[model samples]
Target: LLSLIDQIPEDQRPPIKLPPYDRFGWFFGRNESETYDGTFQVGTGADHVQNTGVMRLWNGANRTDYYRDTCGTIRGTTGEVWPPFGRLRGTPPNVTVFAPDVCSSVTLQYLDEVERYGIAGLRWIGNDRMFDNGVHYEETACQCTAPEDECPVLDNGAMDVSECKFGAPATISFPHFYLANDSYHADITGMQPDPNEHRFEMELEPYTGVPLSVKAQLQVNLHMRNYGLTLLQGIPPVMLPVLWFRQTAALTDELADDIKIILILPDIGVYVAYGIGAIGIVGLVLAIYFSVTRWKLVGPEELPPKRAQPVMP
Candidate 1:
């Protein structure tokens, strides 16, 4: 069977493709809103759990700046609010959960405010490094209907209900540096975002060989649509892509084998050859220079340098 599989043509083999992902897009103002609901399975057998928190901004406020809200609640397996729900009128909320073990799973449902602009969804995955610390990994699957009473204006002058579906799913992954050992910790780096297909890839150095007891925290940001007439008309809305990361214990060995098979020209080899060739050319030039100078000399010792020396008295 292995021999037969190897005999198959390269083109006949399945192509390597990324996992399913999504991205969040801001809505153009017109009294439109979006929501997302999804079930997440936490791997790595984490002991503790916490919601990383949510951020949002309205028109005239700084773009990409999020003020934490306090209106959301995280429910446990018993259907009771885990940390208790808080009211958020003008602010976003912090939805965190503390799970008992890694065997637990949770369903996340989030609703955005009704704005003339639509909502953008960001999906994320976590690494073991996020456990115990106040970090998280989350993904926003897609939008759904807002809670009955909390739904915003159905139709704004500029927005149509049907247009809200334009948003795509994106995967995002990055560390929540704010929860690091120091408040002045390094900013989350190595984040790659692909808005078109809604995918992201990031490597975590801290979570490499940690035991299964370490839980991975997924963090996601669901950006609400901005409704400013200037922004809606003048500036093109930027796509908020999602990110994800999967733990692979065998990745290191696999990568090492790949490097061995790959061919790369060595810089030292090239330079050494060039240096030897250059030295040979220089030696030939010096021989020629000496021959020419001697040919021009009156005698074997009559060259300028030899002549310049005083005769032995």
Candidate 2:
């Protein structure tokens, strides 16, 4: 069908009568969110990855097509056993392409900025230098040479993630949604993206390095081009935004309840032990008091006088 669309000229191409397009997208039930069902067919044909029960993100499966930047250099100068994919890499583009989420961080300074500015903060958190968290927050967002930057490129605080996911076929992002720098907004001329709708965030308990609430969000897209294909000839040769989702783990009511339990259980035990200890102490004092009083007062009152021999009485 794609080839057919490509072969058809613009004038010959009618309204392109099609059904509800329920078949437009393929579902693997991997990252589909119940909260959203947008118009675009996400992961339509590409990124067809499924669980192999391996309990790992990259299971040696090729889930993406290899694409080059304008410089004609394939990503991953190292030996990529899987074309666009190299061996199991943790940071930069490698992990992001096959992995679900990139572990990134915002500096204490930037987080402080967010707190002060609310959601409109723009403090440079230094390019993904945070190492406290085990996740490598790639610096540099969008990884593009400008123009047609509609697809999401995560903020990841300050990490440059341009090298992620081969930097083209699909983009791994922080779910900035749209609250990214104005420069990104300027590049997106194809879509009307809402910053509030697509924004991703993390609320961390700074002192403890605990993520109070977090939304590890990212987006997947398709890089399309005319390339003499009649099907895509009418549209601009750009990376089209398909679907964006997040892996959100948060402090929910249940988790909060568990935490409360965790906090209160010890205290309850200590308090109970203290109460028992107090009772024991009080009992010991009362016993001592009763014995002393009986010996000194009751004993003296009830004590029989020392008697002489019976013969004398």
Best by lDDT: 2
lDDT of 2 at 195: 42
Q: Candidate 2 lDDT, tens digit per residue, 206-252?
A: 22222344444555545455545466678764444566675555455
Candidate 1, residue 298: Cα displacement in angstroms equals 8.3
Task: After the best TM-score superposition of candidate 2, give how far the Cα of residue 44 lies from its true spot, in angstroms.
Answer: 36
Q: For this target, which candidate reaches the highest TM-score against the unseen true structure?
A: 2
Q: Which ten residues in a row have the lowest lDDT in candidate 1?
A: 204-213
Q: Which sections of candidate 1 miss by over 4 Å?
A: 1-249, 252-266, 293-313
Q: Tens digits of per-residue lDDT for model 1 on 199-248?
A: 11121111121111112333332232444324345433322323333222
